[model samples]
Target: MHKRAQVSVEYMAMVGLSLAAFFVIWLYVNSSNASIQQDLKVGFGKQVVTRLADAVNLVSVQGSPAKIFVEVNNPEGVVAASPSSNSSCSNVEIMLVMTAPDGKTTEVFSPVAANVSGDLSFLVGNPGLRRIQVEAVDFFGSPCVMLSG
Candidate 1:
């Protein structure tokens, strides 16, 4: 009877240890996946900002009216786009706001340096198609506008 009881206790201890190890691994994978998702969002935001800045610079240098199309996959839509003064260079700030499945609104700000003139226009909505247009009204002004499709 003593030997049987000892063997039962050992089995239970082994089972408990296995469960604990599995739980730890599961938690680690979940956290890692979350981190990776966040990183991807930030990277996409940066790319959008860079592309917009490049478009603006191209129009400004060429001194003519131009149009460029941009596709954005923002869940919360685009909230704002404006020129912001920086100490080192001129920057355009693009803000993207996203809503989570749980109804939480999150905003991501991306800034890029470019010689932008005039105003910018963009619409906010679910992840989908979009367009950007650069128009030069005169020698002194160049505006970049985001059009809805």
Candidate 2:
């Protein structure tokens, strides 16, 4: 009887330890998934900002009014897009608001031009159909304006 009781206690202890280990693994996996999701959201924000900057630069260099479309995820909205004076050069700063899966909002800034000559008609809205219209203007001191389509 004493030997049988000892064996039963040992078995129960082993089962308890196994359950604890399983619980730890489950918690780790859940935390890892959450971390990966946050990283993906940050990466998406960076890609969108970089693409917007590239599009604006391309239009300015080509000296043509063009409509560029950008794809975005669950974006909160565009906060601001205007020409701002940096230390040495004037750049068009595009501020985009993005939301995470946890309902957290973040602002991403993309500088378009290092030296913007004229005004840029930057109109961006709707995450599904983001439209940006760049106006062709004279880079030199001469005044020039191009009509938008």
Candidate 3:
């Protein structure tokens, strides 16, 4: 009878250990998934920033009100027809935020149906050291890319 009891206790202990191991593995997997999601969010934001900066630089030529065009690209498969040239790249929404010398910021949204030209807000204060920031957000309202000059 003692031997039988010992065996029963051993079986219960083994089952408990198995359950503990399973829980640990589950917790690890959950943690990993959360980390990946956070990473994606950060990466998405960075990409949007970089692209915006590039677009601003491309359009902000010289020290004058030059008409500038923009192309937006969304790599997360969230936006259609990314890196679009001209107005042909439709349906995607974008926001252009420009900061002037007075530390004021202005925002413009798409349908930017026509090419725009103006003293970029960033250049208002300092012509040579003008700072320009453009941000394009996807349809989901997630930042696609932001460009700085």
Scored by lDDT, the top model is 2
**Backbone clashes per model, in order?**
1, 0, 15
Weakest lDDT window of 10 consecutive positions for candidate 2 = 140-149
- Which lDDT values do the candidates have, in the order given? 0.52, 0.53, 0.42
Query: Once model 1 is optimally superposed onto the true structure by TM-score, how far is the C-alpha of residue 1 displaced, in angstroms?
Result: 5.8
Task: Tell me the lDDT of candidate 2.
Answer: 0.53
Tens-digit lDDT track of model 1 for 12-122: 999999999999999999988876776675566556556666665565555544555555544333444453222222335545554443445556655533344333334
Q: What are the models' TM-scores?
A: 0.60, 0.58, 0.40
Candidate 3 residue spans exceeding 4 A from truth = 1-5, 62-149
Compared with the true structure, the alpha-carbon lDDT of candidate 1 equals: 0.52
Residue 89 of model 2: what lDDT? 28
Q: Candidate 3 residues 63-122, lDDT tens each?
A: 233333444332221222122332232323434344323345433344322233222233
Error of 3 at 125 (Å): 31
True lDDT of residue 16, candidate 3 = 100
Q: State in Å the error of residue 140, model 1.
A: 7.0
